[model samples]
Target: MPQAKDHVYLDHNAGAPLRPGARERMVEVLSDVGNASSVHADGRRARARIEAAREQVAGLCKARTRAVTFVSGGTEANMTALTPNWQDQGAPYYLDRLLRGATEHPSVAAGGRFPASMQEVIPVDANGLIRLDILKDMLAGGGPALVSVMAANNETGVISPLAEIGAMVAEAGGFFHVDAVQAAGRMEIDMDAWQADAISLSAHKFGGPQGAGSLVVRSTARVPAPLMLGGGQENWRRAGTENVAAISGIGVAAEAAEKEAQDWARLAALRDRLEAGVREICPAVTIFGEEAPRLANTSCFAAPGISAETALIAFDLERLSLSSGSACSSGKVSVSHVLTAMGAEEATARCALRVSLGWNSTDADIDRFLEVWPQVVDRLNPEARNRAA
Candidate 1:
């Protein structure tokens, strides 16, 4: 776990601090004892709470209330969306195979429950945007397919051309699923406008409890089959009893996150300032996706001559929290698959560092970064950095 104190935290892409509204509601629901399936009044209250959360999460995607299905987290939501037709034998579903973005989260890129052969990648450009021409050529001859593209990337914060992608998928008669976990609170996403068939969201990414998430389908009639069969919950779209407190937290957090999205301009300005400061410290620093559309609160740059591992250790010693691309696997920094998809050279990709801001970030945090970051960069020698390069 990332230890946070008086230290500055620039890893909101990993997790945001829990919102007070969510915390309060979670505590209240914690003592309201009953399974959502029972006939008693307590059960009725629990069910109502869960349904209310469904509506709130749906609002974040501008989706129908009936189409939302609660899940464990973003991973389960992505996994569930990919395998909806897994058990429907002898019935022709709308989609026949999965085509995901090369830069998708590992959960979507590598976590599909379908057979490996059924899944393939859609490449991206150097700016981290999906290559539409290549995608069109791939889609033209395939059987009705399922396309998985993220609204915003977790690593470079690159925003995809969703409306255009949706149009292409529609023309090809395929279903479009968006892994929207990173964009939930930072940007507005309307299912109708984006033409997404299914969307996944995580609570912790938007100031809610970490254990809850949602999959909001564009149409209730097209809900995916439950991944497991434990009990009659979520109208059979998902099984197992709901987590009452966590669901309540998601409800309040969603409502709060909607408000948070309104302040993105300010966050984006702050991010730009941070990037400018980084450039002054090291003129050769490269900011990924700098010329493309991206989330307002994210800045990913590689200091010209420093390895990310050395920079991370130096930053930690200075009490500043940052990450090299997305959260590393098992606390070990590995080369980013996202940068790789954008065709980055091995050394450049390995040295990339991501600094993500959030709702609580302020001028002080930026100042701290500007103050200590130069020192961290100045301490590294190019000759010593070459070994890791």
Candidate 2:
């Protein structure tokens, strides 16, 4: 068992370590007692904090503060975005259809379960990029449609061309929804610039408190009927008392991340070093999405004959915490849907490991990982060592 002292987390993609600032903010908010919707002074203070968070989240996405709607997390954000508003008198007929990338996170994928005939999957290329031509074709043939494409792949970190896709969707008079949960804070995200009707973001992905996320909808965009209705919270789009503390933490974290955007460049350098070390130590290893632009702090790699589960366990034994893919899944060992969509062989997909970094990462952290990685790989696949010998 790895002790806390030995563990070097490389699973920021799963969730970054909550920053001290975010924690302090949470503590500060928790000490207060007020319902944001109430009319009292304390309530007004709470509402102010919530509004500040809305602005911060909106700024992160280059959206208007009024366009931001808080949700429980990425899953809720996705579900809310995908849900249709039958109540809208002018709702498009295509609103009945939900088209998404086949490699989308389970939340988006599961949203398709509403009815198979009403759902369509846009295929991806060998590099895990959505097949834009197919998307254009589908849009041209569409009904009222909701197209959900993740801005960046959670497993492979391959960025989707949202600007292009959003334009295509708009040309076809369809709603464009982007799952920016993984893309937020890692890269520039401009909801208006991308022309995205809606985008989802999770605070935990960028050093904020977990259980807090937001959906950004264009001011011109029509609201879907509420996914949950009661108490008329979130402008009646979502209902429930606000999570004031978590939202406050998200605001602090977003402000910190915005102020330190250059940190991503630094983390990219460390990521490159880690990747270079892995390639040097294991020449046969294949890095996924190497041909395309990716998140600065993510590197997904695969080595023949060594399953991700094995490598993960070996690394864990060495006190290096990493992920096989999205932490939303149960087991660390599974064939990566992203890899499969990208045309990776089952063996290669199963062998892939995702090493992600974040705000807490340092040069020494990367060095420590490089130091242990070779031994972990060797221990998991002694045959590779024997072959080299």
Candidate 3:
């Protein structure tokens, strides 16, 4: 679907616009026919494409090409990683429990394959940072645990201290898995530096087409147990026919996103300007995780007395596309769990809105949104409007 001429998109964290290179690659693959599992000449070509994509994804994470296991998307990648059964050079390496950040995505909050009794939550500070002292105490009481945390938060754009968290997990002799879905193309990913056992990524979160992703393990020898178990696909790691077209798109997008990271500072400046504009209009606006290091392209804030649900409708009518929080909530606006975990009150949490930028986001887009801001406030918040007048 073509976007309206006047519409502006600012919801990169929900899913980035597909890169042109990725779109072209996907189109090329869609016209071809071959199952990657087959050994015929046609299949060999498809297999080569998949392998090449794996290498590109590995390069994004600074991991060995052999460590990348193609999956459906971020959710599947996380589910495949957060399991009790893992192997060290093909031997049974079991984890006794699961520990995840309280502000994690809903997929991580579900505890994946672990039972409720075996799962624990590590609290975050008021600024949405994980409490290191509390995490240290929790680790001391647990057996070989699997600690799952996102490299960057989807709602607040807060960057976690992955290296520190990884060191703590290593000291506890536990496994570490990072959901780098939001951080994949936006930030540098060094699996070794973070000492992460595995990191999950979704192609769509970057600039690829949806439906393709990967779980990149630090070592193929020490990987999670096979989540899918029917065929000898993905080196027996995951089963099912590969989405060759989507995988091709992922490779192209990965290559492009790597190049695009250099221009991220420009996006950061735009985000800063966007936030400043919001604060200027609504001086009482609260920016979540404002003091923490955040993704350069994200600005999540809530103005007091302006209901997010009401503002969203106004924004939509104004042809401004953004989100109140995570787009995963099936088209409904509700209180942000991320804000709540950071000790925000229910009223303030409900007002939270996330404005994330992307590779193609421009100053014009930010200006257009800022231009529409006061009108939205005036319509939904009459008291604030009167005070401003």
Best by lDDT: 3
Q: List the residue pairs that clash in candidate 2.
A: 93-144, 94-143, 94-144, 94-145, 95-144
Cα lDDT, model 2, residue 234: 79
Top candidate on TM-score is: 3
Q: How do all the candidates rank in terms of lDDT, highest first?
A: 3, 1, 2
The lDDT for every candidate, in the order shown, is: 0.85, 0.83, 0.90
Which segments of model 2 are wrong by more than 4 Å?
Answer: 1-3, 86-94, 112-114, 326-328, 383-389
Clashes of each: 0, 5, 0
TM per candidate comes to 0.94, 0.94, 0.98
Tell me how far the alpha carbon of residue 103 in candidate 2 is from the true structure, in angstroms, after superposition.
1.3
Candidates' RMSD to native: 3.0, 2.4, 1.5
Candidate 1's C-alpha runs over 4 A off are 1-5, 84-94, 382-389
lDDT of 3 by residue, 1-389 (tens): 98988899999999899999899898999988889988998899999999999999888889999999989999999999999999988899999999999999988999989999999999999989999999999999968999999999999999999999999999999999999999977888999999999999999989998888999999999999988988888988998898999998999898877777656688889999998888888777889999999989888898878888888889999999899964455788877788989999998888888998987888999999989998998888856643441
Model 2 is weakest, by summed lDDT over 10 consecutive residues, at: 85-94
lDDT of 2 by residue, 69-170 (tens): 889999888888786553334463337688899899999998732466788899998888899999888887857788899999988888898889988888
Deviation in angstroms for 217 in model 1? 0.3
